[model samples]
Target: MKKVIEKKVYNTETATLIAEYWNGLGEDDFMYCEEYLYRTRKGSYFLRGSGGPLTKYSESNENQTWGISTIIPISKEEAYEWLEANDKTEAIEEYFSNDIDEA
Candidate 1:
């Protein structure tokens, strides 16, 4: 599990991250990529993902960078489908469980 450090970049600054999947283990620094689920303050859902050479410059003589990224608006149902397909089990149980949290 190589550590993933997420930042509030130009695109996701207005939303709250709900869950993420980072495929970084054993990947070269310049080849890591990931996906994330997010929700807006108003309850809208979206997905943001990045792939390819996200860290192309980290080992080079230049500033670092994240890979190409994309944001897609999705329905709540779609969000759940995506999460399940990606095996985000913890996130599903935590965020969409029928049993309510007492907190």
Candidate 2:
């Protein structure tokens, strides 16, 4: 995997708060910063953030700020393996045993 480092500039007010948050992070303090592919009911795919097994799906669309329709956790190793196996597919979307409720 290629590592790309991009710098983002936040406004002075936001920068202060962000810097504080960054400084507060200890070695063990980490969030699930991995991006995983999710396939919607329409068969369209999109990348969304994964917060591992404990992450909850928002009850309302209005509360879903992450642009994630669902929370399905896939590990980096598994994602890489799928990419290797399928020449045309870069990422793999898993289907649940039970149909997901849209309500």
Candidate 2 lDDT: 0.30
Write model 1 residue lDDT over 2-100, tens digit each, in one string.
122343232467677888878764345566767789877777677776666544212323665445666767788888887889888787887678633
What are the runs in model 2 whose C-alpha is more than 4 Å off? 1-32, 50-82, 85-103
RMSD of 2: 17.9
Clashing pairs in 2: none
Give the clash count for each candidate.
Answer: 1, 0
lDDT of 2 by residue, 13-88 (tens): 2211100011232333233233334333433333333332223322335543331223233344543443445432
- Model 2's TM-score against the true structure: 0.21
lDDT at 91 for candidate 2?
A: 24
TM-score against truth, every candidate: 0.58, 0.21
